[model samples]
Target chain A: MEKPVSTSPLGQTLAVSGVSHSYAGAQAVDDVNFVVPAGSIAAILGPSGCGKSTMLRIVCGLLRPGVGKVMIGDRDVTDVPARERKVGMVFQNYALFPHMTVAENIAYGLSGLPREERRERVAQMMSIVRLEPFANRLPRQMSGGQQQRVAVARALAPRPALLLLDEPFAALDRSLRADLQFEFVQLQRSLGITAIIVTHDQEEAQSVAEQLIVMNKGRVEQSGPPAELYDKPANLFVNGFVGHASLLKATVARADDGNGLLRLASGSQLAMPGPVGFVPTSDVVLAVRPEHVKLAASPTPGALLAKRVLSVPLGHLMVHDLLVEGATPVRAIADRASESAELPRDVFVSFALDRCRLFPAP
Target chain B: MNRNGLPFLLPMLALSLAGFVLPLALLGVFSFVDTSGSPTLANYQRLFADPFVLSVLVDTIALGFKVVALTTLIALPITLLYWHASPALRRVIVFLTLLPMLTSNVVRTFAWIVILGRQGPISQALVELGLAPAPRSLLFNETALVVVLAQIELPLLVLPVMAVIARSDGALSAAAQTLGAGPWRILVTVLLPMMAPGFLAGWVLVFAGATTSYVTQSVIGGARLIYLPQFVYREVGVLFQWPSAAAVAFVLLAATSLIMLAMTAAARHPRLAGHA
Candidate 1:
């Protein structure tokens, strides 16, 4: 079905700049700045109480920032009231009105329209969410996923300029959450809505976002494509937050011609990549992805031998924890298909030099 | 189950059966009986024929509805105030609102009479301010009865409505505002629908209580405005007519029950259920 052409013009860009907010003298969001491009999904990934939701509220005009401005397209809506902002939101709990039926809930936001138009729009939204069969049922009568769909339909009924979702699938079970994630992605694509979602689950954020902003303690630690952030983190926090990794303490032994040797605490020396910009004798922490480390039967040159402490099977992969030369344990993900003939208690672990990132020790 | 537990529950069940169900059943039986020295329908016949009895019954029903309407009108703002108020302010407001209900109904009725009677505080204040020539009497009127009845039942109306509003998720209203609903529209379209059940419960309760109340009505309205309860009291106590008084009591009981039944049915209707 064709949506009514937006006569007010479309593709409004939202920019939040230098926004800071506090509650009772404790900062909740501090100097956070990011721009959501027109017709793209921006996911804010953070731990609980990291002020991602506070930032979303600020952008949606629900809360005013202490210092900074929010601009949508050309209008500075920092002080505008929430009702006039035309920003639709889907709450974490779905927040569908339990007292209203599916159709009534959908029509609630369109109350300004003519009665006949409101009815038509509600029918249109019900079909969009594929809830026509349960349109007359109250929210309490529907399942969790169905209620979530109704909430989305209700928020989208008015063709809001910017759509905000606060952990929209947090209440759903794993299977339902995955299915709704795909459905939401497809719906967002079809509607071309510029949307922002705040979630603590990294995988969920990575799956739905075109660009991910990793937030920590009321600040943006890093922002980039999910793959880029996972492959090349800008800081120690993003390195651990984006995916599973093992950190190893190491010191640069010698440096010459843009290449150096890193000495581990276990008295093992490994060749470092030339691109790692660090001086000789400098201490740095090495971040290595679990999948990057490989187990070999025989010791290759420059490879370190370690005793396998335990092998935990996780579906198709076995994660082996190894004690390297009596030092701290390191973990590697070995494919179960290839590790079927495993019989060795000791193994050599090695990784390509380019796979490791070096950060200065605190 | 323990035998000792059975003894506790048995007495409660027996008391409820005797104190409540038995009285209602007796009233129903008396509603169909006669009192003209024979097993005829003369009592019920006389009840329907007397214009004075019919007028008093109508007046009672009308006053019941009037009190319910006024109570709801007063309680809506108070409930909203309690809902959005700061915690400390809410505590104080709630305490003050309930202060009236905690007092004896007879005492509150007398307080209203003192304020509304001729040469009373309100009448004297009006006279001194030249709002009226002398102390004008405001008591012994339907308006005074309704006002006093509403004051007595205001807490009943406010508590339930405020409880519903307080427990509401609040997220739905926030979502409505984000969807472009102003405060007024959000109240009417979202908050009110969610709170309809509590409002209906309060209205029915106050209406039932006001229809059956005698103290407030008798004290404020006096003998001039004869409600159904006062009429029944006059028949039984003043005229010493027991059978006729029983017949009038049965009529009032049936009317109040039917009104409550209709309200319950309306509340359960699909159209209203959709909103609530």
Candidate 2:
């Protein structure tokens, strides 16, 4: 694949502070705040109906926040109308102008420019998206992936300070989505435009974004690098949301400042390293990721028993759903080439002590 | 074409033969033959020769164009608003507007007459409000014809456009705005282009309804003002010229068909699309 025209154009900073919105008296996005660095790809990840859509509108200035200030660069655009904000947005549906050709759709944002300039910009965008061949075609005639590229090219044509994408790849198949994701990230990096993408998909977020902002119920649970957020999450929501994790009910057995002891449901005391801010007798939930949960071929210390284990072959690896007593099903990943793939009926599963997270019980 | 489905289509086939095909066949015969039963082009020749007839046809075409223009202007905004309305309000607006389509056209014409008559509410209000001199009729004029025809055809235009808007996935206007086009620019560049099908359907419906409507034009136009439908009605009713009337009606139908074909062709052209 040709490297998509990466020239660091120096994207502007986008900061939204204390942004909150409500629909029909019900809170949708509440007091959400974040600052996206210039030229970086940021993702706002959430589940369905979690106010991500509402927050998207607010960030783009389509809907005024009930209380908040939005800033692009150094200027405060909280009260500015959507049209004057110079923010480029790609809607979830791609929202390509159905009647306009691909060229016209890209030229739509450049209307204020002279005719020659607009045409030149459209041509440039078509080249960047590698859609020159389809420039004369309508959006309906193109595949889902082609339309998505056109949407990105159209938004990037005007060179807005910030580009907002609201789940632009939700319609594509897995392979196509992955290909476009890589191309778009390259295009975004080459263009060096600050972009904030909203998606409910964790994998897409992890693959496409350099910085991930996890949202739940109109609140920002955590905002950091995807890998950092995955390894060390702030709370229970972030732990489960950023990636798959199993939770076990536990209570504080003892604590000081450096290390804490947790009493598991089976009356076993496990030591957890942290500031153990909770009270001495307070309850907590132990969060462990699937990859960190290892299935032992033989009985190992600090290992949990499995009533039944089933390995699902998924090309490169297998997902072993281990039935741990007094806990929800624990899913562990084992290499397809390993002997652990052919597990016995009853086996022992253990968690990596260093990788476990402890959050106060919700 | 399935044997089982063929039986289900019988009622539609029967209705088409009886209601559409049979009358069209009769109109064709009548249009060709004179009252004395001689097949000649005398009626068509006379229709083309007479300046009065040509003017009436031209006036009817103009009226149809006006009807399409006016209905689109009046209905597009309302239809867009209806599309954006809450579910409860949308139901109420739909019921109120489409209620007229269910009511008899003759009844609606009479209602318009009462409203625009010399002693009607409009005239009375105009006199009382000192906007007009004494009690004058707002009916029996070209302007009055367009106004009434637009009202009668507004819902027809609105419903089809509303259907098109409802089927869209995202708010194109919002997308356009974020892309830096202002509201007016968005309307011109994005929404209007996206709504091309809606406008095309609305224009065709309003044009056909306006050009063929006899009751509304006669009652609203009164005796002084004459349109193609009124001219056709007079040919048979007063002059007792069935062949001439049938010929005129057929010409009107042909004109409507040609214009509709032109419109459909125009809709295919990207630059010319939705220009109407």
Candidate 3:
């Protein structure tokens, strides 16, 4: 297939509003609504079977929403069929046509264009994915990463308004996954095309996307910038899913103007701002990220006593598991350093008050 | 074969030798022998010189082609349906498709005789619908034989195709759809090429079964249609020329196997799949 005419690299905003879908009467995607700004990479992150893939399919028009609509740029395309939707998809398995060559696979969707133009477009797409040297190779003859790039090139050759990837790097190894993720992010930014990747790996999502959507069960848990979702989760599920965090049980022992003296299970009272929808003496859970737990040799006013259990060193990050007297384990992460090698058996750990999220029991 | 599998295969090997190999060897010997048990090629020579035998041979080949065509036409769509059918519907379809295989061919042919004979349901329907001037026999015709043989061999044509479609995981069609191809183009370009192996297998199975079939030809076709298998039956039963019958049977077997070999070779050819 030849190359298509050089269209504008600028992409359009994709809006999925009031979208919900069910399979065999069980909900798969529930009332999902999110707007992805044009030319930005967005990632929908969730565990397996958490409806992240379902949401991507609906946005690509692969699966029709039971209710609400989808819009690409300013056009309402909810009623449009998958072929007419102009949204491209790279499947989890790369689904390149087994019988077609690299160039032919890229040219499949470009049949509407002239033959020479389609061929030229295929060549350009191959070079964009750095697959020009393997233009005649079958998908089976290429490596996983090469096949993945071919799939991406095939999806992009038609100049679709929006692109969807379902677990794009799942079939790759850990090292190859990161490399391809980096390449994909770079290519997407250079092309200035809207991309929505569905993955269960939060690190991959965070590394590749500017906007992140965390989903659970059949609903969106949170949708915002990756940093915001990591720093300030809206709920317990998001807090546990997006990053490593330990949730501790607590209750408000005293309440004052916009503040509460929360008592931990260890019987230590830490004064913090009062949480919404809860009164004094109400049981609550506090989400404290590992990085926020500061360790000290001596007991501080608001610190809790814990015995060090084990420490794991990986790259620059060191994770220490410390157990309280009542058998509750609290994990803290600190950067590895020369001076931080030896640790006391008994250490005082204080939670960063601003970094913790106080919430009711899920 | 492993030790355990070797034991399991003993029964099949013994049965094939007793049932297939021994009989084939005997048939070969008898084809070149005279009534006095002396070896001679006179039987084969006389069999080939008869124009009637040639016509029957051509008709049987033509019938093999028609049977394959009709079975494929009826079975391919049904196979696709079974591939995508719901669990409950799939079970019912599988059971229905295998119903003809349960009974012996002789019994099924007897039932077909009653149905395609005069005053049968079809003739009655034709009379009631005024499609025919009056109720008459629909039996003993090429159309009747084709429909009956297709029904008999339909499962053979469908099961292989169903297996292929099941393993494909709907990936090719989904890819085609995402690539802007409509349902028709996907069916033509993606599906048919991939299912070529199943199509060839089913065609060969049905062709061989229908070509060697004797009960259906004798019962439904009666004396009107002189097919190869019927000619062999007559040479042995009526004319008492067992040598000539054996010679004709050998030729039929050789032709069927040769055609199957050619068909398989063509099906596996890479160029057929657009894999340039």
Candidate 4:
């Protein structure tokens, strides 16, 4: 992951404030607010139907917010119609004009330019996307990834100040999706265009975005860098959402030294770093990532013992689900390179202190 | 099953062949036959050489083109209005337009005759208002024929053109507008081009119907009209000149076919072909 630069010259800022919208009386976006700095990618990350797409539409001027304003670099363009807003959007399905060849589709948005300039820019965009050879081939004739490239080229050809992509890579297969994700990041960097991508895929959002806005039920739950979000989630929703974490109910034993000893439901004591404003004897839930849980044959000091219930291999890692007596299954991801095949049936698991998060139990 | 189906279908096919193909073949044969009871090119020669026949041919051709052009120009805006109209309003407009098509052609033409004729409602109003000294007959003129034909064929034109516009992917128009094409430019550059097939189909139908019209012209123009179909009817049915009537029929068929061929060729252009 690259460090986010504090500032950049190509910055084109977009601010969406208190924007609320609905469809047929059902609210899709409720008082959503965010700022996407210029030349940076801000991702609206959420599960499906979380109103992320609605927010994108409102920002692009496709849909007007029932309340509040959308500002692009100091211009309040909330009421502006989609065409005149000068915001380019890429649809999830690419939405390429099927009848037009690749070059023609890329040239569509630049049609108002002088004929010579339009042709030159189209040629330039075709080369930018490396689609010069297939310029005359219709969209239906191209592969999915190629068509997606053409779509991106078409949207970028006009040099829109703000680009909005709605689940742009949702339709591609996994391998192709990763390739396009890197390509899009590189393109955004090169062009220095501000963008907001709406996606439900957490891995995609974490990998491509500079800032992540996690949303749920038309409200922003958390917002920060992907690693920060994964490491210190604001609430249970963010903890479970950003990455795989098992929630274990525990009672805090003491509050001294900024740490508390928690007794799990299975009658095991585990050390927990107290969250800000938390006190001793308070009930709390511990969030521990599966990869941070270490598995051992014999019971290690400060480790909880459990019986091995199942081992599921996920290509490069193995997830062991253990039945800790009188408690929920404990999940641990073991790297395939370090794990031994002849592991004992009963094992003990301990959490790495740095990877655990504490939140008020609810 | 095949044997049984063929038995039932063969007679209808034969009937159609006799009713349609045989007459066309006879017309083609007679078009080259002269009046001296021998195979000659005299009829065709007369068709090309005689000023009167040539003038009538020109008039007929001009009427076909004029009717088609007028119908298309009138139908396009009306169809676009229909495309954008609310569902209820669209239904009402469609129903009203279809009323003329439902009525008999002769009745519609006579209705026009009554309105445009001397002492009819139009002339009565005109005369009553002292717009003119006396009632002037509007019957028996090319203008009256055109008005009647256009009214009669309008629904035919509207239905097909509307279907085309309705089926066209509206995204193209939106795409055009987003690309900086204004409403009128979008209509001309995108919508109209996409709707060309429907317009072509409608124009062909209207042209063919108007060119072959005998009832409307005869009823509207009375005895003075000399459109090709009326001329053919007079020659064969009234004067008993079957050969000349067949020659005239062949000429009309050739003209209509040539128009269709030209339209088909124009439709093949890359800009227009993409619409399909």
DockQ each = 0.45, 0.54, 0.38, 0.21
* Highest-DockQ candidate: 2
**Model 1, residue B266: what's the lDDT?**
70
Cand 4, B chain, TM: 0.88
Per-residue lDDT over A1-362 for candidate 2, one digit per residue giving the tens place of the 0 to 100 score: 42222221448898989998888899999899999999999999998988888887887889999999998889898998877777888988888888778898898877677688788889998999999999889888889999999999888887888899999889999999999999989998888889999999999999999999999998999999999999999888889988899888889988866877788887876776565667788988889788888787688877777755567878888888877864557888867777534578788877876788878888
- Order of quality (TM-score): 2, 3, 1, 4
Q: Give me the runs in candidate 3 sitting further than 4 Å from their true place.
A: A1-10, A22-25, A257-259, A266-268, A271-278, A295-302, A305-310, A338-348, B1-11, B33-40, B83-92, B237-240, B271-276
The residue-by-residue lDDT of candidate 4 on A1-362, one tens digit each, is: 42121121233799988988889899898888888888899899999899987887787766788999998888788888777766777877776765568888888777667788889989998988899999898776788999889878887777777878888899999999999999999989988999888999999999999999999999999888898999889999999899888888888776677766787777778876554346767788888899988998877888887788899889999999887764667789999878866679888888896568888999
Span of 10 residues, lowest total lDDT, candidate 3 chain B: B267-276
What is the Cα-based lDDT of residue A102 in candidate 4? Answer: 88
User: Which residues of candidate 2, in runs, are more than 4 Å off?
Assistant: A1-9, A253-261, A266-280, B1-7, B83-92, B237-239, B270-276
lDDT of 1 by residue, A1-362 (tens): 42342343444788989999998899999999898898899999999999998998898888889999999888899999888787888988877877778998888777677788888888988898899999889887889999999999988888788889999999999999999999999999888888999999999999999999999999999998999999999989899899988888999888776778889988899887774678888998898888988888888888888899998999999999988776867889978998757748988889767887889976
Instruction: Count residue pairs with overlapping backbones in model 4.
Output: 2
Docking quality of model 1: it rates as acceptable
lDDT of 1 by residue, B1-276 (tens): 557777679989999999999987776566565554445567778989999999999999999999999998898888777766877988898799888877898888888888898968889999889999877889888888898899899888887777677666657777888877788987887777777877887888999889888988888888888998989899889997666787899899889989988887877766455443
Give Cα distance to truth, residue B10, candidate 1, Å.
Answer: 5.0
Candidate 1 lands at a TM-score of: 0.84
Predictions in order: lDDT: 0.85, 0.84, 0.85, 0.80
**Which ten residues in a row are the worst by lDDT in model 2 chain B?**
B267-276
TM-score of 4: 0.72
List model 3 lDDT by residue over A1-362, tens digit each.
53343462347899988989999999998998999999999999999989987887777777788998999999998888887777889998988777678898899988888788888889899989998899888777789999999999998988988889989999999999999998998999898999999999999999999999888988988999999998888989998989888888888887756776888887878888454346888899988889988888788887888899998997888899988655678899888884254779898888887778877886
**Best-to-worst ranking by lDDT:** 1, 3, 2, 4
The total of clashing pairs for model 1 equals: 0
Model 3 vs. true fold: TM: 0.90
